[model samples]
Target chain A: MKFKNFLYIIFLTTYYSFSQENNSSINGDFINNFQSYNDDPLIGAIAPEEKVLNNAYLNVIYTKNNFSIGLRYESYLNALMDFDSEFQGNGIPYRYITYTADGLEVTAGNYYEQFGSGLILRTYEDKGLGIDNAMDGIKLRLNPISGVYLKSFIGRSRTYFNYSEGIIRGVDMEMDINEMLRIENNGSYIFGSSIVSRFQEDNNPKFNLPQNVAAFSNRLNIMHSGFNYYIEYAYKFNDPVGSFSLESNNYAPGKALLSNLSYSKKGIGINIESHWIDHMEFRSERAKEKEFIINYIPTISKQHTYTLLALYPASTQMEGEFGVQADIFYKLKKGSLLGGKYGTKININFSKINAIKNGTSFLNDSLNIRSPFLSYDNDKLYFTDFNIEINKKLDKKTKINFIVSNQKYNKDILEGKTPGEYGTIQSTIGVVDISYKIKKGHTIRIESQALRSKPDPNATKKGDGHWVMLLSEYTISPNWFFSIQDMYNFGNYDQTQRLHYINATFGYIIGSNRFEIGYGKKRAGIFCVGGVCKEVPASNGLNINISSSF
Target chain B: MKRYLLFTILFFFLSQYIFSQEKLPNISVKNLNGKKVNIQDINNEGSPIVLNFWATWCKPCKLELNTIAEDYEDWQDETGVKIIAVSIDDSRSMSKVAPYINSVGWDYEIYLDPNRDLARSLGVSTVPHTFLLNEKKEIVWEHRGYIPGDEHKLLEKIESLVK
Candidate 1:
């Protein structure tokens, strides 16, 4: 056995042997999914040498009083077809030891943290998307006074199994004005500020590069009885970043401003959010793109739940994009004529993103990078979406939902296509969902959805075509569920390419444990959780998943 | 190799033993009003409580919460239980949570776990994961995923705790 494995065995033995006499507690959870792949030339799916791939994660945490330590073991046996190939090995990538006492906390090792809406610095792990930016080092948090909070950390971002080359140092402080001033029954105002600096060795051969790049952000939040407003502004020093150019060496300052306002009542709510970002692509490595980001630029777009509506999820354009979103939700009173027996709920959402206008000397003169007006060039539209939905309960046994959406996606910009190559796509989607309670423990749900889009006439027919999907799910309360779904591409320009993707699933749950078996021809698409996305390739496979938690 | 196998077997048994006595961690989380409170202090005054981990963007999480909301009043009256919804929204969508809940008219205590500190401590990897705690705050039962009728199972689990 490897030395590390041997050490782990010895440690486990000692811990378990002495656990009966101590009050310390150890708990863990695990999830494993295995798939056997079959290649299909029609949809471009390939099988690896293993023919079968499995992804498993195990997390165990040991807590004793106010101190705890935890670690996660992950394995990707010849990673799945669509997942990142860098995760084709097993390792203990996450481990941390933390102690808290007397309003003070300290952590050493891997940790995830966020400061002020994560505009400037946020480290987190989203295993489904294969994104774990946990910082590896030390963090300290202290609360000296009743309403004051302070935290500071210095670390290197974790990349795959190794740490990044750049060193990250940051501090954040938040103060509650109401609490600090002891103002009773008054509105609450919270103020926060953060500063983050990254230092990377200058290795570029062509031009001068900043060895130390710094970013700072400040935020204010005011809340009073159903009214809330939050705003944050951030600025980054001049640094050369990857902007899809290998030969160009340009340094530019980055800036971002995000704001949110909301007013909510008993049954009605309205919120408006807007943000402007300019040259704000910050990464641990200037040459890296997409994955190794140092800051998170929130996608100010609605996260659609319906399958058809989510087909064209929006990705944030880090270079420069101005976006705004608004949402309104209202509920019809119960026992009213339009409301039926129960209340009817209606939701409307709209969002738009546009490319920011750049100055002529933005690349040549670093000082000219700043734009005061934050103007967006109307000619270049990145994305736009507007959707509305209504949910109603017809009777005690039945419920229904109706939705309609209109979306315009810039294929050239969002998908990284050549400029003016694919131009844009305009799509309209409609969906209907109905669920009926047949008995106390038996229920059935049916979902029908369709998407119609204007395809690019200049290119060969592909995914940008009219599509329809039908899904039916049956559930036996508390234990079992079965589902079958089919998605048909009926408007493919090429006749032979039009096909139906079908899938079936069976699942059982028993007290914190779940087992599922599925057989399906999966479609090629981008699956997004919350703006962060992963591309899943087409596959014909038998899939099995097991998960449990304590 | 045999030693490694033995370690795995021992771990499996040890995990089983620990899980049977699993209780809520004392991780701190923020309430809807932005006040900090420890998870261990969030009891239902000796009544059963349901701890649900969810997010605003998760479809199944919304469905599960909505379904439970429809019968929450009756569930509370019958079992004297409370349901606490913990949102793992993070800073990305944390601003929308308050409005979203108000608009949906869900009458459940909501908490914000921006960094997922509480979630990681509790080993919750995905949303729509729920735990049923008895009067003593010991995790008696848990379930993952939510279908249309999953709330029936939750109600039954709470009833079992009462029994």
Candidate 2:
């Protein structure tokens, strides 16, 4: 491993030399201008890692006039971290050269694409999750007429550091009927429809999954004085697979139906969404595991950010579930008793999920498992969380926010590995966040929260109860901050279960760079980004962090 | 069989504990010496630190990092600071980190966290999940995701500890 790293460094040095020469000569004028500026050498760059097993990639973007090109050269040092270093040997992960002009766009090579809320088709990359499904091929967009747009693409799905074998072709058309009709009127409505399909030969004999799968979606947006509404519906056909089923003889194709509706005006906005999925598991390969999920289920819950409040973030079950979400935002005008001088804002959100009921005919079958694949009678996985937040500016130097939330979750299905043991779990979390600016250079924030969950069979211990948390952040101008947080497990089975974890941190900043050191006891939980999350471990240790940019 | 099941459960919990205890990745970075050095060695090296990731074409990244570069010296004087810039630039732009630093005259320590191995291990899904580690090499705090003016917030955290 060490020898390979040395060789890798030599290769990088040679490659860097080559690129430098190439860049210096290709864009002399641009480089000269960029160089003319007193670009400070002390500008921060990416932070240093404690270890460097596999070398990282170099990404470069150059743009001249209406043309722009991006190239990323990646190298995997060693498969020491969670990432697969082998990707480095797979060649450039992403390289796209494109040009845009006169309402027309063209791109060749690898690129990420999303269409109309991304319900039907969304080819995205989440490097953190080691997921990159960028389409490798060609894409074109043209707007011949105002309010009428056209987009088409022919490519293959991105696999692990490479493109898939199947061919994916798609075309999308969107028309703003109001604009097309040239109506200078209020309450305008626009409608659009799109179709995306994937074609691959069915080579697997055991499952005989459909090689050619097509899905379509339609959307409508309406606007009027103080109110706007948007809705979309999408559906996919049945495609049996060995992974989604226990036996080929009992294989069943899957489908999904989704819709979202919303309205907003001035200081108030409301949104409602619903989704029903039946075996809608789509994958690039039939044998892929949880890592190969191609589609996502939009969760319906307030994504808590605080340590204690976010202890249990909801994870969407892809196999099948019925879910709904509602959100409302309203602001009270300033000068009112409730609004205060600077105005106040209020936000409320609720979401729920449940299993879809199924027939009992297969109940006697010993082959069937009750937990992971529970056959529900109503097929409804009901979960709901309602949160209300009121924000008010107490004075010029202070602002306060008070929030309360009630949530119900299905622990048996949500966290349970089997079916018959499935049961619902409920929890409540309330928090108060207050920010006070002591002066121009000093600010302080205090946060207090309480979380309680009902006893379930899966509880860490019998009668597992409630938790309390307190956190404070003090900040001073230029580059100083201090924070301390504690979680007190006050309720539940064991009196000894009352665990207190506390942490304090200090940071210093020089320019765009920052360095911080901290010590504390931490708990274990899941950390999520963009609806996808990973489990984070608990640790009691000292930590150092450094970040900079240039 | 029963004993085996008990062992498997114990193993699962033990692995979880160890995995959670796993610290951030370490790098053997060269300080323009071309001689490799571990990142932990830089602690208490007597300079305020700056760590940033940049590519040739990340406009926002260049803009944010450069904006800080313009005023880095003043920040250093006010707070004893040292900055280290690590390039996520691949083989294509790997050479650019040096010249880019030189041409830009960014007097910060520079290294490479290529293939984003470190970034992934740190749960850095986006370009700027910045962190502030104290002189003890302990990660005091971190923030994931970034927008304009986020640097100011980061500066506040650093400034609070300077005194």
Candidate 3:
């Protein structure tokens, strides 16, 4: 860890020098344009109870014509999140220089890369999520010919505060069949394939794990007339581990398979996806903890958007599961009664997932010390949601939209807690959203939603009941806006526990700078961005903001 | 007719090039107080807008915003710029927006894109996915991650546009 920190600092210093030279044009304007604020003594010590320690970073990118190089300097005040204490000192987390010429791209030091669907091969980094699986090795991308592409890389996966001990390597090639085969005149069809393998020496005595593991996948996409279709299938080999079995003598690696199919045209679309896994647990380091898994298992459930509808979200169980999902979307064209003046869109989706049932039946005479693994059951342990939306032009100056949703969710598994030992719990939710344009530059939106669940043995006195919410926003054109919202817990669980959250805000826009102020009472909830979520602590206070570019 | 065809082809290519400029998708988000504002609606009105995703709990995010607050007025006057600061703060710190902004003295337009539905749709994986959109509502450029001094470069971009 000490060596890693030393190397990181050197990299940052070098990058800083490089950026100073390359970014000379912009640097001059920056220093001349903005004023710096004096450091506030309280800024560092007045840490909020719920907030992570403060960290700061500076990054500069200099691009001249087609060549660009960038560097980032980061300092973690006290080693935030899972960062090792060894790396507490301020330094550069990553600094890389790259150049692109024609269709070939090359990068040295650090970079992020991903292959089709990221199934088998992906080396992306997300600093906010504490995920940096970037390969610290050479990467080569070559479009040798007009229709064919090739990429290869050899490196080590980024480990906490350092690179992994194991060497990682992979190669990828994709051919645009339509262009490569010169069939563009007869419509277009594209086919591609990829294989990724990893090798790591194992010295642990508990099991004799295979050092070399490989996974492969194939993809196809076709477009003709007004319709388009895409499909991909992937499979991984077995690799046993301590987590899989307690019996030291009979352990074997696991296998997995996944596939997706979709078609779309004009105003109609359809999608179907399926996944099955025997024991495929892919991770950057097998010895690492479970939460540090680099790869992911796709869930078949639909991701909800509305506040109440998203109260319960399903997390993919990586161990063992088989599932399928289907979605359909259609729209009534403009001028039709259902479509109104603009158009009416209808969306329907459903998904189900359950453990794969093993075929072994219990024997009456057997005194087996080890129970057979549970097999998939006909019993449904999943969730489903349906919604419809109507969009219409009320008049020359006004437009309106309405949406309705109904959802059913599996509670026990999603929430990771249940009231009963073996029984499953289900929840139902509904929501309504409406937006109206009262006049030019003026609009208002309202949303009301609720959720109800069956009383569970573990439920707190509140029998499965209901919740209600009201939100309204009024925007006045060009310079000013205001909004108010309230979430009221009207459910049966505990009436007195029912809490109401309210907020009101105002904003002003001047030139390129926008200023806003607000006051409100908040609640605790998981805030998600692109499937990545963060825990936000509840607070009650005033807020102000100012921002501008250039 | 041939001339018309040529004109049509040129128009098609031009429009395609103009629209495919890597701009983030237009999304409606609520202000800190809960009013809905579409990102494109602001950018479409001939104002270059900076859309920054941030969180109250994120220390770096606070620093980045604070840094901007100190220089925002000059940036706006020189470049006809607007900053649409979108807070990803969840319910826990949702009410802290007004006081927080007031204390920081930032004069940027502040809105709360809570739940991050809009952020998800736009592939915003982290805070500080600062996007620079032109007057035509096209995303001209974007940078992921931020550090101190990076705002200076952002200002340079704005200056280039204004000039």
Candidate 4:
């Protein structure tokens, strides 16, 4: 055993020295988030018993000559206050080895992949959302011919540190007609198809569930000089799903259609997107909600960056919803009337979504709600937004951004309340952001925002009051930044109960390393990444995050 | 435990020596024209390249690129440096990238990493991540997170390469 150990050590040394002369290399990144909770009565923030919670992740990869291996180590010391308790452990849950050749590649262990806009399958990671559903099996990617691509994978979806009970398999293929058919063209025309399936044993006592369910998707993409068009349609067979309520059953077929058309140029752009999803909630394990998501529904709503504008962010309804969004962008000339000294840019966006019109399923009336294609339940509007933004630069060192928007959010649907329980929250929001450079290496920015909410006489929601936000940030070139923000629910119907949520943060960055610390009162609400959301209890805390990449 | 420490330190140094001039991984990203292009093919007539990792929803990323846009033409004329913006927008906002870039009237080349495959390969955890490459396409310098006036440092790096 001693001789074997010596030989191993010798081999490692030789390998290390040889790597220095070869193309072998290593790269990794690290991130740690630590927070200390404290009780607060104002915002109803509560301290967890653990007092301090932490989450850390590290990724290491080594590569050499068409071969690579990677592993991700995650530690959640009782998990953070916002994360699910199931992730309260440490493990190397993600590890993979991949080999690449001229036209083929293979990966084993864990991998993230997607197919055709991810309407059918998209396995990825979002640390903030506590989601990492990489498949733990094998994947194959092949480029058989010019402009032809094929991919297939068989695996089990990861849930925290463990794999789900269901087995997932999928295959995707794409062909570029211009290249495969040898057609002469200045644009690209591609056609793709995908099939994703899941298998799990059915032990439900109330209903007979499908042991295997498959979904198929077809898409087409066309791109010209300044115009692009893409469309995808997906269909899934009737499968009885047992939700978190293990005994309940919903046998429904799923269908989804999404399309986007856009045209753009140097100074002008316009786009329109529409999608309708019906009974399309899919998971590797049918009982899991957002935990083992085997597919991703594109959230068509605009992603806002302003502090107040993001409070009532739109959520995608996976069961049945139809939505459409249109965006228009135009830039006025530098010297034009509306453009001012420097050019001004105008952006207009409008989006509307409604519950799909449905009736008893003709095929299975007792189990499913059937809806016609593109059918909209006009009375059940889920969400709607109309916003416009104008950005202009007054001089070389001064710039301003102004936005005004009106939105109607169905609180009942978005917050998972009973239908019509809280009705709709309609509000008008306005924001102004200004930035000025005082010196070559110094800058300051100020943002002010207001949201006017129409009160609900018969509802019970905490934050529907009129809100105003003020923020100021000072950045010292290349190194440090400090910001303070206050969100005040000033015009609450219950005037005595109004609250101000103030937070302050400081950060420093040197090279590829960054460190940030903050003290704040967090709001209690549904925290979402992309369209997936989870409720996070309110917490008063001091938060620190440090990250480094090499 | 001491032996393990030795092994770790040795391997760390070995990696640095080997990857001091590491090239981008071989991954495919979609150009603004919605066509697949290999990472090695994105360049400007053998000039130094700047591969910026950004996202459509990231405000700082937009700020960084917008700040650089003001002097892009002059920088190109002086150092022949080309800026290539890689947006890691998922399917949720992939379709908006082209319009967003065009409305800003930026002349830089744009690529889309819908699945963030390229971003992951490059060890980019945050948006507004910038990488500078020499004529040989080897990553020479990288900076994470963008602060106002940081573009000057980037310009300095490019100037040194051409000088």
| Fraction of the native A-B contacts that model 3 recovers | 0.00
What are the runs in model 3 whose C-alpha is more than 4 Å off? A1-59, A73-91, A125-132, A159-163, A242-256, A359-376, A396-399, A418-425, A455-465, A476-482, A503-550, B1-163
The C-alpha lDDT values of all candidates are 0.82, 0.56, 0.55, 0.84
TM-scores, in order shown?
0.94, 0.65, 0.65, 0.94
Candidate 1 is graded, for docking, as: medium
lDDT of 1 by residue, A233-297 (tens): 99888777534346665666788899999888888988899998887777776677667887888
Which lDDT tens digits does candidate 1 get at residues B1-163? 4566456546745655653466677587888666667898897889999999999878779878988898889999999999999999876678778888898799998999988888888778878889888998877778887776778778888998898
What ranking emerges by lDDT with the best candidate at the front? 4, 1, 2, 3
Candidate 2 local Cα displacement, residue A109, angstroms: 2.4
lDDT of candidate 4 over A304-389, digit per residue (tens): 88867877878888777899999998889888888887789888999998988873232343554468888888888888999998
Highest TM-score among the candidates is held by which one? Answer: 4
RMSD of 4: 3.2
lDDT head-to-head 3 vs 4, winner: 4
Better of 1 and 2 by DockQ: 1
Where is the poorest 10-residue window by lDDT in model 3 chain B?
B11-20
